[model samples]
Target: MEAEIRFGDFVREVSLRQTHISFNELAAYPKLDNKIVPINRQNEKLKVSLKDIYRILGPYTTVRFVDQVKAVIPLAIYLMFFQIFILRQGIADAALICGGLLSVMVGLMLFMEGLKLGLMPFGETIGNTLPVKSPLVVVLGISFLLGVGVTFAEPAIGALKAAGQIVSVEKAPYLYAMLNEYSGALVLMVGAGVGLAAILGTLRFVYDWSLKPLIYLSLIPVLLLTGYVGIFDPELAKIIGVAWDCGAVTTGPVTVPLVLSLGIGVASVVGRGDSSLSGFG
Candidate 1:
């Protein structure tokens, strides 16, 4: 605690970059089980009073806020500078834009916090527990449903549904229709694809299968469909963009950590061979 408090961000940055090291390899490795009291700093109790809430939250809040600020502010500043210098365009309603950016930063932080505290742990717990208790078929069925569920829950999909306004119907009828009338169907299909991918990913990890063949197999149909659409059905070619976006968002916040946790949990239980990490081949 004392070491962390002194160096703060420097300590954290160094810790984040540190690779996995065995305890035996670490310097000053403690063998004794008994607790050692530090003379330099007073020990804090596990329990905290209501008055201590601000103190407890202070460092965590700062770290989270700074993290979000790093993610959002730099790109925003670069874009604003580019607009001013390169484009020679003044930023209209700069205050409103700043407020919106701040809101986005706060929202992202809360979203991440929610994923860590509620969603991720829930997924990991299920992943860790299910393989031990349930049958293999049940675990897979759960994975499929989880993929579907996360797709439906993804905030980006809802935003994607509203992205049709910029797309001209005459130029891209199928794409326009898919985003509007057939949006639900499109989303369902994306969800199904993600669910299937999750199952395959889990199996790949456990069976120590090559990812290259899967990639080749997957790309075959996509390339064929894309080529067919681009050549024969020019009207549907515009939808390739939408299709790409759909594929992209299935890997969004709601789907990734949760599904990955579930898959990893299954793998840890049912995995074969001595492979810790699978190579590209």
Candidate 2:
């Protein structure tokens, strides 16, 4: 007999090699008897100690925390030096800045860990399972929705919106309106574009289409639109930079892993291995 035990993200299989042994005989085995008795009693107690919890989670938390520190520390140091030395001005409120930076570091650590341990797995699982279990339309629908959801959820989108807050309305009323008043609609438009891109990208994976042609086709429309906006709507033309920035920011930390995981999972399942771009799709 074999038993599979799952502990958080870890799994272990235990096999009873001496299946024929009776309860009395099992008790006679010194190492097995010693370990199994305590484990069985512990299970019966049904009590979890903080130490045990820490043992299970400590390494994962420590590694993720360290990774975030390594990522954020350099930026923090650079900013501190630039503010104190180059600018010759101390931080406005040292305590507040420290608290805020600590909070950000912790939040980023948790978020990154969650992405690695949860979201990426979920995305890959859905991508791998959908094509096999659901209809093609359903898979495409899910992909489109995922794309839209990830784009809207991205942190970089908020930064783009923030950039709009300082834009002088008098200088570019239309741009300001789109960024502030019609921001929801603007986000929807960008999300829709991303969703469509995801749909086409998935289709390309399924049918083994060349990415080169798609790139050319997309560029033509983008160039023509840029020219049209530049020529016709000068007020709205001010937003051309922001509009292009939206595309870049759409593929942020949250979106890229989720979308890439989904794309790679689907491609691995349905695609021909011969294609040079099988997983790249």
Candidate 3:
């Protein structure tokens, strides 16, 4: 026989059998106290003592450190082998290089940890919260500003600028001039491009726009400009490497996740159903 059961607003159908009956048969029945106990246990776990916290965290910390070492060690070994064995060259500032390598490893470890613990959560929170609290214009505006800000602050920009020091003034005077005299303007230009990209990316999510058309439209102007520079501006052609690098580097670790989060947040609120292109920005 089948029996219908109703409790509060919920209803379910159950079969009653004559063959056997057991406590396990009623296991699916809802228990008010059972539900509350798990929640309370979760709350208790959150309120861990320092000793308990260390015990829980100790293995994870060691694993993270080991993973970082694995990433960095191979390159270090290769460089050492090439310098000492293959090239037969004496290492200069052995102590300094060693120190620098150690520092880089430590910095990378800290940076990874910071991204996981800090930047990702912060970006996700801002992204998820901003759309609900603000208008569309406000959301786009914030995304644009964030793009510009992060692009300007990107470490790769500084590296590109430093690379300008090696350019021979006689061969590429304009390139040298742009990198050295007008570097601030160059960074601003790249920042503007990134900001525009961020705005468009956000809009794509809002409208469920296909990435294909956007990609084609963007590439047309870029290809035209590249061809024009290649044909007419020989000097500018030389610094095209730096220009491309600037564009490439603008979408670094800091900018990508933050912008993606913001895009996802806005998309979740405005769009009706999840699209294949959601959170792509």
Top model number, lDDT: 2
Q: What lDDT tens digits, residue by residue, belong to model 3 across residues 1-281?
A: 33222363132112211233344443343344744653333222224457555565655565566667898889988999999999999889989988998888878877888876687667656666887898889978887888888887788888888988987899889888988999999989988888899889777777778889998998899889988998898877887778778878877877776667666556656764573236644
Model 1: CA > 4 A from native = 1-53, 273-281
For candidate 2, list the clashing residue pairs, or say none: none
- List the lowest-lDDT window of 10 residues for candidate 1: 272-281
- Sorting all predicted structures by TM-score, with the top scorer first, yields 1, 2, 3
Ranking by lDDT: 2, 1, 3
- The list of candidate 3 runs beyond 4 A from truth reads 1-58, 81-90, 271-277
Better model by lDDT: candidate 1 vs candidate 3: 1
lDDT of 1 at 217: 97
Error of 1 at 126 (Å): 1.8
Q: How would you encode candidate 2's per-residue C-alpha lDDT over 173-264 as one tens digit per residue?
A: 98889889988888888888888988997888788788899999989999999999999989868989998899899878898889887876
TM-score of 3: 0.72
Candidate 1 lDDT tens digits, 1-281: 12112367467545442234343433333344446743444434355455455555655676777899999988998999999999999999999999999999999999998997799768867876887888767877887888888999998899999897667887778888888888889989998988788778766765678778999999899999998988997777778888888988877888887876675556555655432232112
